[model samples]
Target: MQVLVCGGTGCTSSASHQLREALRREIKARGLSSRVRVFKTGCFGFCKLGPLVVVYPGQILYCRVGVPDVREMVERHFAGGKVVERLLYREPATGEKKLRLHDVHFFQAQQRVALRHCGLINPEDVTEYIACGGYFALADVLLHQTPAQVIETVKKSGLRGRGGGGFPTGKKWEMAAAAPGAEKYVVCNADEGDPGAFMDRSILEGDPHSVLEAMAIAGYAIGAAEGYIYVRAEYPIAVERLERAIRQAREQGLLGRRLFNTGFDFDIDLRLGAGAFVCGEETALLRSATGQRGEPRPRPPYPAQCGLWGKPTLLNNVETYANVPAIISRGADWFASMGTENSKGTKVFSLAGKIMNTGLIEVPMGTTLRTIVFNIGGGIPHGRKFKAVQTGGPSGGCIPEAGLDTPVDYDSLRRIGSMMGSGGLIVMDESDCMVDIAKFYLQFSQDESCGQCTPCRVGVKRMTEILERITEGKGEMSDLDELADLAREVKDASLCGLGQTAPNPVLSTLQYFRDEYEAHIRDKRCPAGVCRALLDYVIDEEKCVSCGLCAKNCVARAINGEKKGRPYFIDRQKCLKCGVCAAHCPQEAIYTA
Candidate 1:
């Protein structure tokens, strides 16, 4: 019997380390350490109820576990052979206990291919990874199949790169293989700098071996002997796990020298990025790996043709490499059968924002946004209406409620002015202002721009200024037209993918929620009551109880009237429009105009 504790970053922040230590102490104290082993593994995906603890061979899942609950788990579940019913994950609506991870609604629709070994195997244990068919693909590629055959299998799988841009994976490998160089390289872009994106980090923390195995396979396919994983310095846990996995793989003869006795030599080294968002781009990543300033160069020759010290290089994100092993093991047809016609297999999304079930989920490509937001995500929180769902982090666009029924695939999402980016899906409800959302993404892109190209460096900044003016109620009608023109200019003139797709949020929001922008600029009214500068807080005389709550809570001393008698009124000049009076009012008398 084994107990798996969530070792992902999210759970670690919630004191999951203490929980793991407590479980180990409990096992030792009860003298069940021999019979039952406690281990720390990667994310279980159900982050809403983390830190998650799962017991296997029984596959019993317990959610929201803490250090204090460790003794009961050991005493009842491990030693006595019974589940702790109070600790099990309960269905919100039905109020029933969900034993297995699959029984939970959040995981029911998800088909985890990239996240195959994530919650299952202990990432630090090489034996556990090997038992689950880890290194088998690399061995098969090196011994039986030729490099061409391996590339063909990937091409047939229809597996586009999961890193922001949906480039063909096999084509990228083939380009590097065909490039005239005896010394080529494979790079894993683990520099996931997108705000609110934890997909790459989760994969590295949970299934580090999969990446190592896949990188070895990539090296064999692309005629490269050495690979580099360019990870951000911010992801310390992922970096530690990756380093450990690499060392373990080398010791087991799965990485260095003749891997798996196949005489095909391949190994990987780690390259730490200095938390630059532009380093997420292929060319910028190549520059950073070479110990230079991380910036993107113009891509006529692309990374596959000329990359990593002027040698042929193949680059793919953490999630993309995570999918490689499953494709090689199960065959292309098996993987292709899961998703839509163009897009194959499952896509992992870090589901966040105003959704009830904000966690990590891997659903098939054809799964509609409605299914993701309403079913798997448990809809929006606080009984609010769904306004839009933002995909692709800062580089992607927002899909309004009208596009909810649209199937989530590469081509489908692209058609709606959004790309299947690193798979960061942030759900937005009615309370969120669309104009503010566009401004937020624009600000992120503007800040992350490498400042190499004139259009990207200047255009993104100008667009942000325009957005800020509009949000602050200082915008004119011409600002909308100016925004469209600037977005087009930035998209056309940018050097790399970072600047090229930066305009997506502005363009898509304008296309879908133009009325909101008009309302902000023309009428100077924030319909959602989000733009504090444009809104005025006033006391509703009819509903006011003359209680001292509003007056006490007001920082500006705006409310003044007889307490517990007549209705109170707010002085417009003294009111800071902070909404503290509105929030403090028990009778809901305060209104924003």
Candidate 2:
């Protein structure tokens, strides 16, 4: 029997390494080493239940496993053939134990494609990748089909780039191939800088070989002999795994020079990025990859026409390339049949913020947001209502409850005033202030702005200042019109996508949650009580028991009350709006008005 342990970064941080070692020691102690094998694999997507462990023969999925639980798991499951019911996942609503991984609600609606081999195979082992038909697409293209035929197949598949901009992948390859240059380059953009997004990082960590194999296929199709993966240095796990996968593929004659003895010569090298959010853009990424400043230039001579030292280059992000092999091996019609007419394939998303199941998920392209949130995500935690889901990272916009039933495709999201930005779906609950949320995203965009352009550097800063004034209860009603007008200007005048999309949050919030903004500006109050400057702390006299904890903990010394007598009153002038008194109140007497 084989035991698979989640070795992804999330599970690894939760002591999955120690658990694996403990399981090994226990199995050896019980003389079951020959029968029971333990292997460290990739992420299982159910990150909330990690460190996850799965035993074969019955596919018993164990959740939140620690080193201490290894012995009981080994002895009960391996020795006595009894299942460990305590470690199995219990359905949140029904409280029924689910022995298999897919039996849980979190995994029910997911249709894994880009993440196909992830969590299933050992990434470091090339044979495992090959066993799953990893490089067969490249081989098939090399032996049977010509470059034109391959490009035609990809075009017919309706495969679009999954890295924010949904550009046609086949059209990109066809352009690179048709460009007037014999020396072309293929680049895999792995600079995943989106907040709360880990889809690319997880794919790289769990299935590094998939990316490598797909890159080789792209190289063959585009007539590119060299490739570079511009990944950020922040992802050390993904970097290390890619390094190992490249070395393994080279050693096995899968990466370097003639593959299947074809005349095509291709190889890939890694270029580490300095964590610049702008580098996610194609032109900016090419600049960084060529050892230049990571800033985007005007794109009339787009990357396809002249890129990377004036040679035609083909670039696609990690998730986009991960789907290439599947499309090539299993006909374009099969992939085309899955999603809507425009977007045909599955899209992987990182579910974060206020959701019960905070993990990785891949649903078909046209799957509604309501299905993703309620069916697969298991809805909001603590019975809180879902306020909105922010898609496409900071550059994307928020979709309110009224838009929850909208299908999540590139065109659908764009039509709703949002874009699919690298697949970051951050769910917000009622506690999240929409105005504050807009401010937070704008602030991130402003800070990460390359500052090479005037519109993004100065315009976004101005928009951010307006948001600051409104949130601080010092804003005028006319500032609302200024904010909207400035957002449009910055979006139109910005040089690159960073500046172009920086105002998305501001514009989208103004469209959907105008009342929240009005409350902050006109009423001088934070409806969600999230903006500290707009909050007025009050002591609930009925609940206050003179516990004195609030008074003792107040650093501002704003609370006034006798130790055992009347309830404490706050001096608004002296209060710093730190919320310390409210946090320390034992009876929950403190509230924000």
Candidate 3:
């Protein structure tokens, strides 16, 4: 009987380490340590129900596990041969307890490819990784396959970059191979700076060897001897695991120097990013990796032809590299059979915001948004209606409910005014203000802009100021037209991808939720009551019970009435619209308009 505890960042933050130690202590005390071994593994992807614990032989999945339950788990399950009934995952819709990991709704829809070894193996142990067919792909590529043949297999696999651009991975390798240089470099862009996006970090934390092996295969294909993983310093867990995986791989001869006596040499090193969002862009990443300022340069002399000290280079993000080993081992046709013609193979996503099941998930490329949001995600929480899902981070667009049935491929999302950007799926409910949502993304884009060129630097700032005015109920009708025109101008004239895609959120929101913007501007009201400046807090006269709580609790002293004598009313002149009176009212009389 084996017990696995999630050592991923989310669960670690929630005291999963202590829980693991507690389990070990209980198992050791009962003399069951040899039979019931406790191991710390990577993320299980169900972040909402973490810290997750899984007991093998039955695959019993325990959700939201605490340290206090460790003794009971070991005593009842390990020693007594009984399952912990209360700790088992209960289906949200049916309330039926699921004993195994595969039985849960969150795991049923997910088809793990990039995340295959994530929760399954001990990441720091290369032997366990080998048990799961880890370095076999690298061995085959190095010993049996030629450089051109490897590139051909990847091309036939129909694998595109999982990063925002969705560029062809094999084609990138092909370009780097054909480029005239002996010192070409392969780069893994692990600088995941998107809000609520932990897909890359999770992969690094869970299966760092998969990336290391894939980089070696890519090196053979691209004729590069050295590679670099440009990861942010913020991901200390991932960094630590990666350091360990590299050390383990080198000691085993899987990385560094000659492999299988094939005489081909390749190795990998790490370059730490300073948390710049723009560095997710390939050119900016290369610049940062080369000890320069993390800013993007012009294209056409793209990274494939001229990169990393003017030598040929190949770059793909962490999720993209995570898929390479699978394609190589499973065969290209096997991968190409999964998704639509254009977008083949599964995509990993970090599901976040107003959803019932908030976690990391992977699904086939052409899966409908309805299936992801309702069936897999378990729909919106609090019985609220889902308004939109924001894909592709700050540069991605918002898709309304009408487009929920749209397939989530690169072309399909782009057709609906969004892109498959780094797979950050943020579901928004009806309570979210679209105008305010657009402003939020624009603010992020503006703040993260590298400020290299005038269009991105000036255009994003002006657009943000306009959005601020609109949300503050100070916008003119002509400001909408100006905003639209400015979005197009910035998109066309920007220097790099950061500047080019910065206007996506604004344009998408304006396309789908123009009514909300008009309401804020014309009626001087926030439709979702999210913008405090546009909100007016008023007490319903009928529900007022003459309670002094509203008046006494108001720090602004906006509510004017005698104690228990007359109904309290907010003075519009004095009311700061802080909603403190509304929160303090026992009658729940106060509401916003």
The digit string of per-residue lDDT tens for model 3 on 315-344 reads: 999998999989999999999999999999
Whole-model lDDT values for every prediction: 0.90, 0.92, 0.92
Residue by residue across 1-593, what tens digits does model 1's lDDT show? 98889989999999999999999888999999888887888998888889998888877889899988988888898888888999998877668998876778888878889998888888888898999998889888888999999999999999999997788898888888999979999999999987778998999999999999899999999889999999999999999999999999888888888776766788899999999899988888999899898899877788888999998899999999999999999999998898888888889899999988888889889899999999999998778899999999888899999999989888999999998889899998888899999999989888888899998999999999999999999999999999999999999989988889999999999999999999999899988889988998888888998887999998888889999788899898888888888888999999998
Q: List pairs with backbone clashes in candidate 3.
A: none
Better of 1 and 2 by TM-score: 2
Return the lDDT, model 2, position 87: 96
The per-prediction CA RMSD against the true structure, in angstroms, equals 1.6, 1.0, 1.0
- Evaluate model 1: give its TM-score: 0.97
lDDT per residue for candidate 2 within 173-228, as digits (tens), equals: 99999998789999999999999999999999999988988898888888999999
* Residue 15, candidate 1: C-alpha displacement in angstroms: 0.9
Query: Model 3 clash tally?
Result: 0
Candidate 1 lDDT score at position 499: 88
